[model samples]
Target: MKHRLVTATLSSITAAGVAVALAACAPTAPDSAGAASSGPSDATLTVGTTTDVVNYNPLIGNSRTDDWITDLMYPRLMTVSNTGAKEAQLATKWGYTSPTQGYYDIRSDMTWSDGTPLTAEDVAWTLNEVKKDKPAGTFYGQLGDFASAKATSKTHVEITLSEPNSSLIDEIGFWGVVVPEHVFSKAGSVATFANDGKDGGWVGAGPYTLSKVQVGQSYTLDRAKNYPLVKGGEPIAAKVVFRVFPDVNTEILALQSGEIDAIGDALPPSQVAKLKSSSGIKVEEAAGLGYSHMVYNLDNPDLAKLQVRQALSHAVDYDAIRSVVLQGQATNDHSSPIMPVLKSYFDSSLKEYSYDPKLAASLLEQAGYTKGANGKFPLNFKLIYSLQDAVTSQWATIVRDDAAKAGITITLSGTDRNTYLAATNAGKYDIYAGNFAIMDDPVTNFTLAYLPGGAINYTHVDDPTLNALIKKASNTTDEKQKISIMQQANKVVYDNVYDNIMYTQNLFFAHSTKWTGFVPMPSDLLSIVNPVSLASASPVKQ
Candidate 1:
């Protein structure tokens, strides 16, 4: 049994190979799930994304820019394998003798892209740096319980927490990205450390190493030959070049013309529909674990009334958005805070709001928000959102029209990405729209958003009971107990306590049929992509 456990690497590699081969052949061959078509063997595949990689930092907004780049350049301590098992990436193995403390055995053979050996001290230093305060620094308070991490040996490390944390394993495995202490140690804080035009700050043990990076044009990655092809290692994609475009329309055109092999994250609904008719352009749709939610500022006495909030929730037409904007590609969320993929933990009893303007007006009227001579609600509120996408603008327009019928007048406001997040975080708006991306567990979502003074909690929710429940869940180690606490906490948040959820939309990416092995990883982290048939792509005729 110990031998079976120790050398599970081959079985892991073989399983990945089979998955890649099967995925590559599945589309062209009959009676199989529609994968992309066959291609001539090649090593380099050019990918198009909306954002460019100016910095190879993993702490960035979990953006596709950061996701695609970091997956190639750096590796985390422990990562979810292709088979969805908790396997070691830099750490050879990890075990917990107690809920508060866990020990990890580091791989002695693993080294950074610069050929420096990966030691436990590097992990310790990076973890410490992540906790320091600076602009856009510090993780959610769920990581607050982390007391200390110390190296026991050259190949072993131990982390001790202030309290029992059940989610520690998943949290460490997810957010605990190891960085080279040798390079980053010079910087006193993360804010002062500059990655500007230099690949020195982020040396990691992933499959590909950063070769060249040009701000808006392209970023190049080459295969890490020295990196082991072990269980949790990134697979070989000889050259992964990400081409950044200005907008989604241009990205779609580039994909159709065969200028790029694949494009992701910025694909629009109309473009996806157009791609359906084009021959040899394969399309894949999956339920993104994220949700595009409408947040109500319950801090306002007018908006604080549960019926008024519920009324506003029922005013907007979800079917219209799902039908007209989403083009029948996305599913209507029936109030599942946890994504459909997390079936075991998701709560189903929460009521969904349908388009019933009359019902909404009545609810508002019953709550004593009677209309004055202006035929509008006795109050005027401001709505704020990200101005980057047409979908957000369109959704805002629909909301404006619906709320007008209920005698509530909302002044729609738009801001740039950075400004939008800052405004929301400062609680400067009455209503907001944004998606929570890259969260795998319910703990991060519920705890961070609704807990008092929590970093992401824009709604200003201040329920002591909710706060206590969240703390209890975070400190508990038993899976069943934690899940029960999570369900109860979600019920408190979603069941007329704090906020409103719009609908969860489907994630769409435009790609040519020649590119094979594109599967939707529900986690927004695109680290584990296996572009196996990249070796078979047609050569650039230039």
Candidate 2:
């Protein structure tokens, strides 16, 4: 999963409204003989989410809610399995033809919801258009080295790159959302096209199609009649509805009251235990492929110093935050941008930052910072975080208190998710605290987060040494050599204290026990409501 730039406004949902919404959206009840009386066509699966779907265009929308809805409608060439391996979806097979050339054999059985054949031309056109438009989403960054894509045959598409990139296939195949060329070729500009489907021109090639959208309320999708991914060539649920809530508390309430069959967002760590004890709920846990971190803007004079950044990293109490704030739900190991789950790439030799206010003060003194009459350093900084994130909200105060112990003056700024993202994109904050849903590929992750002019380079790091190492790693085809290069790059990042990785949390998702066949993915964004899982899931007959 990639980062989203905007989040919709929170809609207030009263208890009375929950009852009415559930009555209208709930699935058909099971009857005698362990079967749905009216058959699967009457079945519905309603999911609860905290954010609303603001963008319907898969190529540009980056929010979790946006991905969840668009992914069901727009099919990808490849998808990740439970263990994060690339699996074929719309493409039957894919392989590299040369060091700088790759190809995919598109499946011929797939067709758009409007009865248009999904062919290699559509795949080539979508990739080429994205490269030309350079949209502000996950796909453009991955296409930095792409030259062009051409359809060799009706079922085959070839991609040419300017340089050798071993990770390009996995990154683009799994992350790229292919749209029908017939429908989108008429748009004025791909970057500005909303593709909201307001005119009933929604065309898709996945298991479902966008049928209705009630802004700030719910997004409804109808199952396609000829989806070849499922057992019967169709999804069990005839309709999938995503209902919006103001926050996680309301979502949990809706799940408990049987209003929604599952929650699209990960359960807060503190609420996991109580939800597990409740009947009719099944809690599933997965290894995290992402980590929460705080990035310091290198443009700031104080943060530019090595000792200042090092002192700030050591000032915070990492152990207490993991134990108290995370409730021991996160991994208590060495903190690095590359999570511990990716053992081959994670550098274990790097030393972990220990909490010692005395050491922090000493480092600050060595950096020529003197304390004022108030017994605090002359440094004052503001940290910005999302107010919707429960974990960040609770731990931010702890971070302020801990930094104060080291004679550092700090201010906390919490805002709505949309505002927080907007300010971050505008470089309006001194220190940015946030988390990514998934970073499955270390090479791609490093390029986007640390490389110069990268999409999510919030820290403003411009070290030539780090940039060279990442570039060298990205141009290699050998797996061992790439790992070695990435490990060296990770060391460079750790030594510079470019970012403070807080913890890698084990994500937990809760769904109704009445439903079965839910596939669990690694990231919270794709845990239970992914395309494969939703298509295979059904009401567990009595």
Candidate 3:
């Protein structure tokens, strides 16, 4: 098996792809899933994107930018394959040695960026560290049931779980980015380490290493000569430069002006016509694994009410936004965190908040809200989002405009990405827009966002019943039992509108003809420029 595993995600959980027409072509085509490039060799890749990595480590860093770079610089036993299933990457093979124990066949040739040999010891240490961090570790919620990882040898590691975790392969592969135990052991604190400035300071075993950071300009990554998977056949690009614009307009302009050879962010649908008209670039509509969600701040007294959250959910029209604003680039996904892609696990019976200003007003009134002299609801709150993102900016406006119809006064607050994340984590707003990449498993996705103390549980839901259901689902090895338990948890989330999910979006990308091998891969939290696909891309023959 290849080192990179196809991450199971909303895009290909089943035969259907990400959206409507996209879903119609069930049993997705192979090329659409991404592959190794057969294009020109020995080229440099320059990509334009909004935002830069705020933190070097993926463990604490939650931005798309951080993930993009870390994916390229880290080693994973497995990765999301094009088919959306667990496929091996660094671990050529893995299997269960017992009911609750497993082993990974770590690649013997893998080495860190600093030339230290990467062994099963690194993998075991990484997993143990992740456990030590508890639910906050990246992808830890998916594997919180694991007991420990012990090195059996230099080329193999054994994993023992506290209980049976059916999603064992999914959990380890998705979050277990191996860190050099030798290096981190002396750091004292992994959380405070800065792997930047000179040489990007971090050690990795992937195809590319962080070479330099030019502040707001770009993050330069140089291809590693001994990338195990690439070996004799290295990535066609010697260097991958990610230029930050912070604004999609600036990113698009850079792409069109030839200042950047590629773009990894979603191109606004309104500009699709203009981008398509250009002869120098080509745009492709590929399935994406991320979506925007409206989260009610539990700390806000007014928004804490179930009725207020439900009213807000009903205040905006999901289908309208998908139709008018998205320009047919999205799907009317039910607010359930589980994508319909997981046909069985998805709670198909759960109803979505249909747009009904009248019903929304009534719900608000029922929840103790009254229209004031100005004919608007007395309660007022702020809707926070990343102002720099084209989609978020437009989405905030759309929701604000529609909310006015129900006499709900929603003050729009758009700020930088870092600031937005900080506010949500601290629960400092009345309402927040959670723009996130979908997780491979629905149970993992749901618990991560809503279960009590779940790392990204911005709402801070404290229901014991809901949390117990999730815990039960997570610890089981039986698929039917897990699905059944999650069904109950899904109901609780819907009944409470834990996170007012907006809609599912297909990742939209446009690249200059100058680059030829990058293709879109399906992932909940990654873009077409996902490291797996990027490694397969190359510069065009000039």
Candidate 4:
């Protein structure tokens, strides 16, 4: 995801209602026996996060914290259900009218927090502006084709595409965030517009509106009067607060001490076991939609050679990392970017690289690199990873030691999250190690991770053959044909060692047992405390 920032502080907005009204508006919750029970209507849910939100503009910023905050204010056309299926959010129904045309029918009852009616015009304008400016975030690539979106009626929208892309609806509908046309149109350029809500007049269409922000500390969101997606036409919580903690350990302590109710980010594998054994806490697990991987920057002359890249891939002990570093909570089977969770698109035929230090040394020697008097190869590449990631910090040492056995010298650099992101974007590292929270769509993921100039193409790869295959896969509408073409592309990536996919681990989320009704989604980023979850959640009656 992309990243940037702006800072501001606003006064908190309080909801006005009596306890009787709150009880009357309470949503029904399932009892232990599956019968209906009354849930809280005026509770405040506090969530702990590792970092502060970088930007308020959903179109420009795409960090995990950004999504958690902006998602509550800005509505998407569709949302992903627990099963990873597309569900209605703002747009009630959607489908392709023809090979090159798609349509969305939005609900008429929904209105912005400012009382302005949210219509098809806003959706069309959002999509069109993204396609026009090509913002440096997630939404632009999801557009896929150069075309236009027209509001056929106040509630209906038609989108024209230059070519048939079967995945566009799922990609764009679920990923795209719509803003108020009237509010955003005044901005000189949407690409640079911070949308920080410095005026305290932010208008939104979802369950809540950003009410208060204490930079490097906390963000407060007040519940909207009405939200159609949840029961009782509103969120159960009167307000939601995201507290920024310095690290995972600190966040965990706060959750245990009741300083916060939930942790927005997934708990690291090392901490999951202990948290599961703790009292008054519930740990939820979900299938991971992404994987940890190492991307070698082709800009480095040594990494540009396929043999050296492959050699480094073989040098790492995958099983050891999965067992020791990940606590055996991860699956280390897949070799390509299309993780095993994506069943239909994952290519199982491609074999994973075996752990063989001898083979690695032989490949380095074959590539004309001889071991120096220090018993190490001439290579001294630096690998950079986020210091905030405990798993990466632990496993990076293993990688460096393992590579040394193969006569390859690797230097490790662990920096803060912001510095790590900036370095990755500027191509400042010889090797980049990180993880993506969600790669829901294979076609879109490939386009963004492997295609030349892709938003997350840290590898700096620009192979013509791989580019052509991705383009071919993107243009087709046939499911079987697309799958076959993508499998071919996966083989190309695997053979070239474009990226070394480490593993996919089951994500675990911890929250207070005092609250319930959190809906778990697929990816770690959205598994718990998503907008839908926050709206559905309620405090357990004492």
Give one digit per residue, the lDDT tens place, for model 2 in 181-276. Answer: 998898876777799886665999888898988988998999888777655567788899999888788899999999999988888899999999
Better of 2 and 4 by TM-score: 4
For model 4 the local lDDT of residue 495 reads: 92
Which sections of candidate 2 miss by over 4 Å? 1-39
Question: What TM-score does candidate 4 reach?
Answer: 0.92
Residue ranges of candidate 3 with Cα displaced over 4 Å: 1-42, 81-83, 133-137, 140-143, 197-200
TM-score of each: 0.81, 0.90, 0.89, 0.92
Number of the predicted model whose TM-score against the real structure is largest: 4
Q: Measured by TM-score, how close is model 2 to the native structure?
A: 0.90
Question: How would you encode candidate 4's per-residue C-alpha lDDT over 1-542 as one tens digit per residue?
Answer: 10111100011111331111000111222343121136336788999987778778999775578888889999888766433456667776666656666677887878999999999999999999888888887788787664989999999888888886766766788789999999889887778788988766689998889999998999999998878766567788889999998888899999999999999878888999999999999897877777889999999999999999989999999999999988989986567788776777777777779999999999999999999899888999999998878788889999999999999989999997777888887899999998987787778888989998788888989999999999988887667788899999888889999999999877888889888877666676776767777877778788
RMSD of 4: 9.2
Error of 1 at 469 (Å): 0.9
Order of models, best lDDT first: 4, 2, 3, 1
Give the per-residue lDDT digits (tens) of candidate 3, residues 1-542: 22333332222223332211110011111343343346325666888777778888655666778878888887777656433466556776665544466667777887887889999998888788767754244556556667888998998788887875556655676566777887666654556555553433667787788888887888988887676454243555788899998688888888889998878777787888788889899886666555678888887777778898889888998887787777877766688776666667777777778899999999999988789888899878888898767776887888998899999888998998878877776778888875676566666776678777777787888888988887777666567777899888888888888887777777668888766556565643456576655666655556
Off by over 4 Å in 4: 1-40, 81-84
What 10-residue stretch in candidate 1 is worst by lDDT?
A: 20-29
Please report how far candidate 2 places residue 214 from its true position, in Å: 1.9
lDDT of 4: 0.81
